[model samples]
Target: MSNLFTLSSKLAAQLDQELMGPKVGFTLQQLMELAGFSVAQAVQKEYAIDDLNKNKKVLVIAGPGNNGGDGLVCARHLKLFGYNPVVYYPKRSSRTEFYGQLVKQLDFFNIPILEESDDWLQYLKPEQTICIIDAIFGFSFKSPMREPFGKIVDEVSKIDNTIPVVAVDVPSGWDVDEGPTSETYITPSLLVSLTVPKPCSKHIDTAKTSHYVGGRFIPNHFAEKYGFKTFKYQSTEQVMKL
Candidate 1:
């Protein structure tokens, strides 16, 4: 499995270059928004349901990075479509600039952030629900879960198996470049990899339904600048066919 999914250091470096370089003109926020929309679109298509923008109950678990910003975007999109999507952002001091901007966007949209004190469990029933969006962690994570975030993951795990989870980028605690963490992790029903599939996608424990999201690829010049290449999934047709 490692041989099949492992990304060499050179390749990983190339990807990072493509992701952060100027040629692509794809900021982290844009990538995140595209990814969130793609995930929502895929969900609607997968369930063979109409009115996706206006249906379903979505619970978004957000962390402190750009991944959390993506979840916030998803929540706003869900609200526009008429779904009651609740966003929970665990308090953290070291948050990304994108996250702060997203918070302001949520405020403009009048979407209230869920407090830890709020009874989130009461709003979601494991057996008779729609979807849970996991955006708690992204590719850069390396440490074990700690404090309130770890506690949040534990609580979310308590949800019955009947509920389906759509994870953004990767599952909260799973490492994209390496293997699973030593601590407890969230197992998403469907894992949505933004831009391209990460090495972790090939892991047997990553997700039952792992799918790649599409966006503009990182340009080669940028990849070269950053010493990595970027690959965007062109399988939207296949996803639509599913």
Candidate 2:
């Protein structure tokens, strides 16, 4: 019942302060890993009904940001758990070093990366129940989706209603700081919010309108000093305690 929007300004200020220094002590890679681990933990707990893992297929829609890095990590972990996750990345340039590293990791894992011209939609059968992981965009995405990304979003939206979607952070195309735009977006069945709950989570029109799975809010100090904070919402255990 906590209102995350009320703390947005404060959180934004803290984030700015943490990034103003010469080097980001806590690299985005570390955050992406933590986010991925947190989501894997949450999904394992929530979807443990009658050995459902045996037949489930996971589809990850990743972009070129830290958000996509998180999805790659999730795909790796999911594969280790005996699930094959088909990862789809739109043709785009990446700005984060962590994202580039994740792309390599995905390749190492032999995870198929779908391109815009691949006709990947044909693989997703209407009756083939799967979980779609939306990591296409995050809080920093401000511009309206265009071209291949827009086309990808449109294709994924056609997935059957029986298929559940797990969105990483905010849903793809939904603005985190602001509310939802008229642009295309995915309405995930569950949203695993990393670090802290995004402001859009509170908006009724946002894509994260269903169940929310909260992740740890790792303070910069944790990365700088390898010290844990006293905050109760910084880890999966802490979130479960809530």
Clashes of each: 6, 0
Minimal lDDT window, size 10, model 2: 222-231
Q: Rate the local accuracy (lDDT) of all candidates.
A: 0.64, 0.64
Q: What TM-score would candidate 2 get against the native?
A: 0.77
**lDDT value for model 1:** 0.64
Q: Mind giving the per-residue lDDT tens digits that candidate 1 earns over 141-185? A: 776777677777776666625677777767777787664673777
Q: Tell me the TM-score of each prediction against the true structure.
A: 0.76, 0.77
Lowest lDDT block of 10, candidate 1: 233-242
Residue 148 lDDT in model 2? 74
* Model 2 agreement with the true structure over 135-203: per-residue lDDT tens digits: 887777776786677877777766624567777877777777665673677777777766556666666
CA lDDT for candidate 2 = 0.64
